[model samples]
Target: MSSAKVWTIAETSGRRLKPVSYELPARGRMLADKLGTRLASVVIGDQVDRNDLQELFWRGVDEIYLVTHPELAGFLVENYSNVLIALIKTYRPEIIIAAATTTGRTLMPHVAVRLPAGLTADCTELDIEEETGNLLQTRPAIGGNILATIKTPHHRPQMATVRPKSTKPLPRDESRSGLIHIVKFNPNWIDGRVKKVGMRQIEETGAGIQDTDVVIAGGKGLKKGENFSLLRELAMLLGGVVGASREAVDRGWISYPHQVGLSGKTVTPKLYLAAGISGAIQHLAGMKTAEVIVAVNSDPEAPIFKVADFGIVGDLFTVLPAFISRLKGGKAK
Candidate 1:
């Protein structure tokens, strides 16, 4: 067997690769370099384009394990886990990481329980411990009030599912190269018990909060559900999406999909505007990576100001209307 390696699972939506697939290798590459091991990425799907798989090399993977079969078109836990277990047993990786998406969250746990290894979920950060060389996995704990770091000392393959958007993908390097090994599909891996019935796509209006470049987020300070209209108007003016803090979601001011925090979606927008959000650590964990942050809060001492590129210490109702008016080429009343 080859020396213990660091591995990242590439996530796909049909034939297209997801963004987190590249992001994982960027971080995994760093960990692999620090641990003196090679970084390998696994892609399992039917008819995934070779050009798309090549992006893994540009993102700093030393090898690409491509497993394809007609039955692998859609994700089924039973079949996917069977294939993954076989690879793990053969390669014997020292570390395994996947995105904390619906597929990853479900697959990793299934693989871990079968391998009987310790697994961490939704890690925001990962590092290598110098003294022991254990993979340090950091995640929010205790209702998102604190961060906890965990290690799998007894396990051969340390496993974790990292939250999407927690880290940015590395700049692509076309000169980088790696080996592509095609793993033969085993029909026996398919489970007779379960079958993929059909897939449904949910239609949504406008861009999703996670995909938008600019995000205007609200919090408890917005006062009521109707006040979210203020944020929607501003978002429309800015050509962005509206996001909300968990507090606002819990109060039924907004739907859960619009919520941004540790328990919610992690977003890396080009510009993030926080209107009336106090900036709890959990909320900060979600959008701290925004290229430019503008915060509006009445309190000068609000934590949001600390991370904001531009801070306005004033009421959101007053500040937001002024912003909307200016964007519309009209003077603030």
Candidate 2:
């Protein structure tokens, strides 16, 4: 008998799978390794992208369950919850891991209520207690005053929604193979409540939030709102996005859409270039998961460099313009 199975939601955008799907399998490995059981992933959508799924196998998922239905194309809270609740009744996993994202934040609570299980939201870390085989759900509490460690002692499947960029992604190993199970999905079962409403994909001006590989983030070091244009130029030159520190947003230097921190959005872009940013703890809480972090700050002792994979000591005004000019093949460094 399987000791425990892990369930994860696979988010899809216009038939393309989102990157968060890869995160759960890596997280499942962490749980299964401790529990000594299998880590399973469930994909719910109208169709499955076989090519995008190859990465899941490489990341150490034991089983992948695919649920397809016409009404499941977009995010339908009722349909998703019902289908997932049914799966939980059937498999009875010891733990269910979901991303602490917009859709997930809305969906997991409903499922938890239906199953009557304890749910942990925005968990920064997940681990299994070696002796008890229990899931340890850790998250910040009381306005970041305390770090709370919680467990679902009586619940069968302890559910948790983890923040993106909170954990390291496992490297892909192509040699490892896994099992794939296709679950039967009936369109009529969910055709009533779930309707495919108007779908419009909002495109970011300079960067696509979903697929940006590199990001150049700015902080209060900028003197005025006009300074963001420099960050944008550098980002465009590097084929990256322009991110903003919470301070910059609060100061009206940039819009909240570009702000990144605990209160803002979480990003796991490959390379994060932080300029003129002091790197507050709240800001660090968000983008700490970048594969390679490069900090460029005038203050030689800024905290941003602490988590940076690479650090550059300089002034953003002088540094960025020079970098852009060099990239544009105009002037010498």
The models' CA-based lDDT, in order, is: 0.87, 0.79
In angstroms, how far off is 132's CA in candidate 1? Answer: 3.5
Alpha-carbon lDDT of model 2: 0.79
Candidate 2 lDDT, 269-310, residue by residue in tens = 788999998998888876776778999999988999899988
Q: Which residue pairs collide, candidate 1?
A: none
Where in model 2 is the C-alpha error above 4 Å?
Answer: 1-4, 142-145, 165-169, 186-196, 203-213, 237-239, 250-253, 267-272, 277-314, 325-333
Per-residue lDDT for 255 in model 1? 82
Candidate 1, after superposition: displacement of residue 195 in Å? 4.4
